[model samples]
Target: MRWSIPRSDAVDVLREQLRKQVRAPFAATAGMVVLLWASLTPSLMPRTALFQALLTALCMLAGYGAGALAGWLVRSCGGRLAGRARVIAWRVLAGVAGIGTLIVLGLSLRWENEVRDLVGVDRVGIWHLVLTVLITAVLLALLLGLSRGIRALGRSIGRFVGRFLPAAASTVIGGLIAAVLIYELAIGVGGNRLLGALDSSFATINQEFRTEIPAPTTPELTASPASSQAWEDLGRQGRVFIASAPTAADIGEFTQEPAQQPVRAYVGAGHEGVDIREEASAAVTELDALGGFDRAVINVVTGTGRGWVNENQAQALEFMWGGDTATVSLQYSYLPSWMSFVLDRQRAQDAGLALFDAVYGRWLEIPEAERPLLVVSGESLGSFGGEAAFSGAQDLATRTDGALFVGPTADNRLWSRFTEEREPGTPQVLPILDDGEIVRFADQPEQWDLPGAWEGTRIGYLQHANDPITWWSPSLALECPDWLEEERGRDVSPNVRWIPGVTMLQLGVDQFSANSVPQGQGHQFGTAPVYAWAEILPPPGWSDERTDELAVVIGDRAWLR
Candidate 1:
């Protein structure tokens, strides 16, 4: 029983098994081509070699599947390569794959260095490239093995069913059964369990209060002793926001003038019995209690999934207005922004509509001339939800005094409409809708200075050209975007090109690293909001000089954060 095959025989058998697992010559060639394309494409942010390897592997797998399906169809229709021809085909493909991989790896290293230099990250070396290849090979082997295992199971089922039915019918039935099983395992049961676990984990995270962020003692902030909302009930981000409000003294020091205490009202999703609509109503009530309606300016801010209001956006408004402002927001989900963007989008829409409608309804009750200047603002996923409250540019102008939406997602309805209808000569990155009469897009501070008399309520969208949140789309898999077709953004690499499936994977991966770069690039807005607000809702004596001074202050403060 302990006796076994000789060592050489075992090695030979293992080698033969591995050789059999290799895909067909044509399919392998197709995968090599896709791998080269994916590795060579420019990314929005500087990607580590590990991420690049993963992206290339996934794209190669897709190409291999497509090529294999094509080969199967051809053979089924009575096409075949003879023995000598098949051997020659394999030889040619081997040469092509080897040469192509070397060339692509070299080019990828250069491109990666270029992007790293642009974003101020360290350049990768030969070791990273070696790691990339090793990881790619390992990932490809695992993925291919899994797929082949599934195929083998299907074939076995087909053989059993063939006993009772025609060969073709049995094969079809077996495939359908396999597909159903995969769906049930991967999505129906597994997906629900995974989501449930994530929800519970994030919910627990929301309940935790960090020692660094203490409850606000000021009457002007929510969850204070003078406020209606309980301190324990505010979620983690809500507590941070409430504690981060600029006091009257803080604003006065910056403005060099007397200032009022800024009003900040927030409602957390951690409240047990409060629905979103009720939370919205409670937020308005908190704001009213703090005399928010009496302020010179009022901003209804739509927060990201976990209710994170941007400090840059909020503080810019407060400082510029001498703390004569009120900012209000409500938490809607416990998930992080990206997960909520994919899974809880409908909740975001509902939260945005509810909060805005509730606040707007109450604002209308005041006499038109006596009401505070109303405006709306959001960033990233928050921008996606914020846009849901408005139909288009005209709805924005009519409903509010001003707006500043930063890093808008690709699915933002109003943003897409404006970009689509932009003036013919303008590029997609900085589109000018209706000749910048109302809504306008800006990347730099100076782009706000468009010609003609800027009239009515000003609405500005601050989007960085390299921000994947603003550029990623499902359409990227099949079609080229205008941003890539036109001149590249100031920060984006000129080498960036559109490769059907490869570009989509590049951008999708880019999102994970978007915020790691310096401000004014990727998804970070930095002091751009200071410049945008100066245009959107400038103070009585606001000037370019003042905006410049404030930008410096904001930049300095951001470094501390």
Candidate 2:
């Protein structure tokens, strides 16, 4: 009779156990907090106070929301798994079936476009997708495990500190410590090394591609003793591999060619034996010797880390000015631009600022009425470095008559500022400030219709929708970027969905694949520059027919090839 009077103890015990499941939510939220703190911010140095606060608040809310959803899912499903043996068996079979289904679906999915978008080849196999999925899954699982470990470690420390200090103080200290450790382990060691290896490997291949392209030469550059000595100094002392300029004969034959041949002064200081400042000085001397100041447009160019002066840009300027422009640039580093972006942005800034300053100082010495139009131009890392010369947009406006930066990196302070303070409702990718008064951005040729023909000193930033260099940032994890929310870039996959951790990883992969396709087709502005510059620095009485012709010639040259 007493045994039949069951004590409701079992029910009480089950309730207590269910209540203890609160830790899952806490753990998940803590893990998310650690991840957000460790990785989601773009840079430790916030560009502005408001932006920093906004990022923090957004991440915190996202982390908490994700944690709550995860907790709800776990709790809702926890009781369904009853007997341990049955639960284990179900898990095993479900895993097998899940994998088999994934394999079948992945093989069936049309991945040709995805592969082509990534590496410019449509020759992808089902095995490739399987392998990619496998690798990505492993990495993501590892990240989750690491985040969990961090949260556990932080909680344990917080409990320990709470014994000797206030609970709030203990929590704060524990969080700060966990954040530091996670950052060091996740970003400083693992991510940096991974990015470096990818960059270095690609650079080796890139260098081979560059070395194969024979450097152009002309007799006119080597005609006089002084010119030959300057050319020799550029080649020997300057450690330059290529120094080319159009001869009188080449310029005379312009009627047959779509673009007029112009003087191009380049000091190849890319290798280890070169001195940056010395080579810059040599480049200025060579340009002066070539009578560059007498040209209608004098362009101070910035090279990528590997010393590529973006021939597309140079060709555009030459065609615009009817081959009357003088372009001068010097090599700063031999590493690929992505490498320098990750490793040595300062060197680019130094080279760009120094070269422009030297050239500008010399240009200032000439009579204002007689001096050639002083213009500054750079692409990719060149743009990042070139913008370093100006303190702000106003500084750029005052210092130079015209500036054109193509595919400027996201971290470029000037680009960031202008984009932020741009006209309300203007797309970030193509902002038109003050009706294109002083600054304008263009994604393609047609979008360059500046109202009233912007008659004063102006700057144009040309960035494609698909260029990772223009869009990638740490904040992408928690907040949707403007580019992704609107029209996806031409090269980007339309099905590219944004998941929390998954999207961040995908973009990282995208950054590497950005240059895989031919230039102008992807990150390279092959023919776009011709169209972009035509709008930015349109020649007096320039016609659409001429612009189309310039594009055709620039595409035909394909100088990088």
Q: Positional deviation of 526 in candidate 2, in angstroms?
A: 1.4
TM-score for each of the candidates: 0.93, 0.69
In model 1, the runs with Cα more than 4 Å from the true position are 1-17, 22-25, 156-177, 271-274, 558-561
Q: Taking the tens digit of each residue's C-alpha lDDT, what string does model 1 give over 1-561?
A: 698999999999999987888835476456656656665567888887678778877887788777777776777789877799988877877787779778888888888888888877788898988888788889978888887788788888888999999998898788778878888998789877876677777888887777776677888999887799987787888888887787898889989999999999999987463378888999999999988999999999999988889999999999999999999999988889998887667777788888999999999999988999999999998888887888888899899999999999999988998999999979999998887999878999899889965788999999989899899999999999999999887778999989887788889889988988887789988899999999999989998999999888777763112
TM-score of 1: 0.93
Residue pairs whose backbone atoms clash in candidate 1: none
Error of 1 at 405 (Å): 0.8
Clashes of 1: 0
Candidate lDDT scores, in order, read: 0.85, 0.64
lDDT of 1 at 221: 91
lDDT of 2 by residue, 1-561 (tens): 356424698788877876664334443555445434422222211112222233333444445556655655676667333578656755664575467545544532444435354435544455644554454345444554555577678878888988999977897688678888878887789776865575456444433433343344542232234343333233321223233343444434433545544766667643234477877787788778877777888888887876777766776777667777788887776566787777767878888888888898889889989988888988888998888788976787787878899988888878998888878777776776777778888877777776656666778888876676777777776777766666655555555555565345445545665675666444667788787777767778887888888777667752323
